[model samples]
Target: MKLQTALRLIYPPRCVSCGDLVESDFGLCGPCWRETPFIEGLACDTCGVPLPGHSDQIEHCDDCMRIARPWSRGRAVLTYKDNGRKLVLALKHSDRLDIIRPAGVWLARAARPILQDQMLIAPIPLHWSRLLKRRFNQSALLAQELGRLTALSVCPDLLVRPKRTESLEGKGHDARFTTLDRAINAHPKRKHRMAGRHVLLIDDVMTSGATMAAAAEACLSAGAHDVSALSLARVAKDA
Candidate 1:
């Protein structure tokens, strides 16, 4: 038997979320897949939140309309609820490196509409202290995988977080934005990469979009022609 097939026989592919044996690798089982709220049809153009009804014209969600988004466009693979939340948490805190493959594929599909020719792929930067604690940046991993799948140029350190901000957990919307303001900046040595190019920022989740706003603003300050964002999950109020 082939070595690969032998390995599969020894250790069957399992669902990323529930650990149930699945038919294929890097995917969820049928139950978990159904529970995961994949965003589809009539999503907000600015934030990728699922909106009611269908429309051909560009539309923005209420939150996006109220808040200023520095990025021109955005997309997200799943709504932050049920299995979606579980997947994001696993990737972010559980050291679930296995989730990167499926996430990259989903992110690439979501990003297709906003993709521009010769665009640069980057991830939201984590503070040095947090990086030390976590040992890895999930966003960076996702960005690298996404670049591999899309054949785009990936700059892992394109952005930097000079100021360490407290966790946004349990913080109000205004507080979240206040804490992240002016916290992120373009890396001095790599700032040239952003000049005159369309940059795509990747993140594991979009909560209040405060972090994305800061990162997008940094890219714009460094002379990026445009900034776009893609996330594995988006935290929507109704979801």
Candidate 2:
């Protein structure tokens, strides 16, 4: 308690999104808080996209019905736009560990329905070359923090990315999948841990779902009973 007080006095508190002053840590200023598009209310059972109007029973989104995801379940806390996109960009460029605290809290609430006692949390790994340059994997940070909050164990080493694929920034949908094909797999020595167990894969963003699809397939091929994916932000056409 004393330590927190002293730190607050020294560093003060700032909004993780807009860098505005706030009352305390892990918070957003009033304007920034309202600006953030937090996904809540009725959402898709499969992809976590907010549904139109109100519903009384479980429902899946149109996209989930037309296109199937490799993972059995999925969750996303916010749409990948506006403040949400800014948050991701800030984490990559600036030293903002505070961003993960609020992200983990939002993710924990979104993933509550899929989390289970025996499930394991694993992050999508960056290729060694990229990891060396970045110094840290943002996805792993989110997974570790979320694991602590949810009392779930995280296995950061369970997955391996042997080759660094080209950036998907300017690629078409098919091109993106071609790049990820056979690019991700479970570590041979760690396969035993995944078999017959549910694995929750974590990532920073889910733009087209290609990365998570590959991760889910790899885990399933290694005998995982089921795989689910969650991301902090997901690109969407609408809520």
lDDT of each: 0.94, 0.86
Cα TM-score per model: 0.98, 0.93
Give the clashing residue pairs of candidate 1, or none.
none
- Model 1 spans with C-alpha error above 4 angstroms: none
Please provide, for model 2 over 176-208, each residue's C-alpha lDDT reduced to its tens digit, 9 standing for 90 to 100: 888999899898999998989999999998876
- Name the candidate that leads on lDDT: 1
Which residue pairs in model 2 clash with each other? none
What C-alpha root-mean-square deviation, in Å, does candidate 1 show against the real structure? 0.9
What is the Cα-based lDDT of residue 83 in candidate 1? Answer: 89
Error of 1 at 221 (Å): 0.4
- Which one wins on TM-score? 1
